[model samples]
Target: MFYRYGRGDEPDLQPTKNWIRRVLLYGAYLDGTRYYYSPDVFLFFFSRLLEENPDSDIHQDTVPLPREHIQKRINADGDAMELAIRILACYSLGIRHKIDLTKQLSLQQEDGGWEIGYLCRTGKTGSRLVNRGYTIALAVNAVGALLTTRALSRNGILIDEGFVESNA
Candidate 1:
């Protein structure tokens, strides 16, 4: 996509914040894991970015300006879930990139969240911490992770008591 639209000044089509988050999530999970083509390159660059920009905000009123001098590396067949998780992690840890890469992998509300895709693929094997299935077990896990991170980064509560209190 970048190559066809590789103009140096081309404007990004989607929200920049989400892209930043997804790229970092992809990098973290790609690390130490074998990919179809080769190892993911962002593992190193993002590591350095995290190392150098430790003060980046996890939650605030404004998005942080990205540094102009980021290094690019090439790799193929990267893990998508890793990318989703890392975006969440960066958002939690304070990179503040806005793209919910998970949303891309997840089934749309129109699809009822049951169909299969890379997002539906299981990461678990041989008694891993996470499970492997398209069952509610998996869906709940993913939603739980997203909600947990979101709560941690902002509201700090899973369920809003105000809504429950008002209903009662």
Candidate 2:
């Protein structure tokens, strides 16, 4: 299906941002069999490298999956909160894929600090861990990524940690 993109042939066009997110979040990791986490790293790079193309017609020839197809990719029993969490996970992964670690770092909520796998599991109320639930490890990882990106962007000069913290 993707081969048609480079051939200059217009295939069916479908633009579903949520599905795109899911493909990047889940399908990218699938090895024609099962899913894995390695795709997260790949996605991080992919998203970071995305250009702001006003004239690009990449999606114009893309085939969009049906809602049922997207529905099957979900594993949280169709719960709205679960779906939201997955989408957030996709954003986190997508930002990383784009290699815009700064964006990933900024995605943190003001309520809680950084941690790894902050929203991986449910808490006391069968709800996923929220930012304010407590300081999780995933948040720390995300924050660290932010710090590193800032330092790099500043050309090895140390940025104000306080400034970074407040911005978060």
Candidate 3:
């Protein structure tokens, strides 16, 4: 949805803004701290939307996630994919902090892919682990986010120069 909007396509802004607000409001809590899933990805979209529509009512202040909260998560060894997302979010939001991009790079599997595991914690029940696929897709997004944020250099990942173009 955000990617489409970022590409200059028109998406209904109201619902997208509302949904982003809701996600920030009712997101998951880890280690007694709240975090939205795929935060960097969402931040990229949200920030792009705000940039494209400056007169829109949606403001960065309206976003519930704080820089400190995100920083704490980054410090806590959160999930690899989520961390990548957070890195992009931080970059988009102009929050500066040291994040070891190598950690995310190191998780790649021997087949040049990444695996996603579920940390399922149903209300009050103990968490269960489940391995899932579509790993290539997730890995691509993760890598893209890293590249977009410049966390990984050209030597680290072979990114096409035209992969992301500036709107300006």
Candidate 4:
């Protein structure tokens, strides 16, 4: 029961936009992630820092989940990588201040590493990429970013506010 997610199956990823976004977004380095999606952030970080929740515009329930199912480690229901991206995005964007980081934290394996279920289908062969090392690195990085953000808020460095409801 192999799913062939050829280039046609995947949304037209600009050369490799989705992959790039997935990595940065999932890594929780949102300042860097913003640059990938919109460059204006480079010049004006504060303006883009407080943007309308990305979730407000794009609802996960509406977007059809990718059919390119390979092997999942934690949740068998949805895309693991996508879940990471969503959680990190909400936290980093200051869009969902109440977003529970524990949502992603709960998926941690006994080994204390996260497994990336599905990264993205390769444009040429459509082979989904899920690297154990890569997953662990990014997941740890995302968690670090989240913790750091919370610390900043506690220190009164960042305003703790959210524009939308929790996606976690």
Winning candidate number (lDDT): 3
Q: Estimate each model's TM-score.
A: 0.27, 0.25, 0.46, 0.45
lDDT of 1 by residue, 3-109 (tens): 23443124553355356465454443433432212222233334434544444431121223222111122112234333443443343333333233344344334
RMSD list, candidates in order:
15.2, 12.9, 8.7, 13.8
Error of 2 at 47 (Å): 8.7
Task: Give per-residue CA lDDT, model 2, range 63-127, as digits (tens).
Answer: 23222222333332322222233333433322222223334444555655433332233333444
Over 87-121, each residue of candidate 3 has an lDDT whose tens digit, in order, gives 55555455534443455567777887666743343
lDDT of 4 by residue, 1-168 (tens): 001232322444443434433433343332233222222122122212223222321213212211111111112233334445544444444333324345557778898977765544456665665677766665676577667766777798985554333454
Candidates 2 and 4 compared by TM-score, better number: 4
| Cα deviation of 148, candidate 2, in Å | 0.5
The TM-score ranking, best first, is 3, 4, 1, 2
> Candidate 1 — which residues are off by over 4 angstroms?
1-34, 37-83, 88-96, 105-111, 119-143, 151-168
In candidate 4, what residue range of length 10 has the lowest lDDT sum? 65-74
Judging by lDDT, tell me the better candidate of 2 and 3: 3
Candidate 2 is scored at a TM of 0.25
Ranking by lDDT: 3, 4, 2, 1
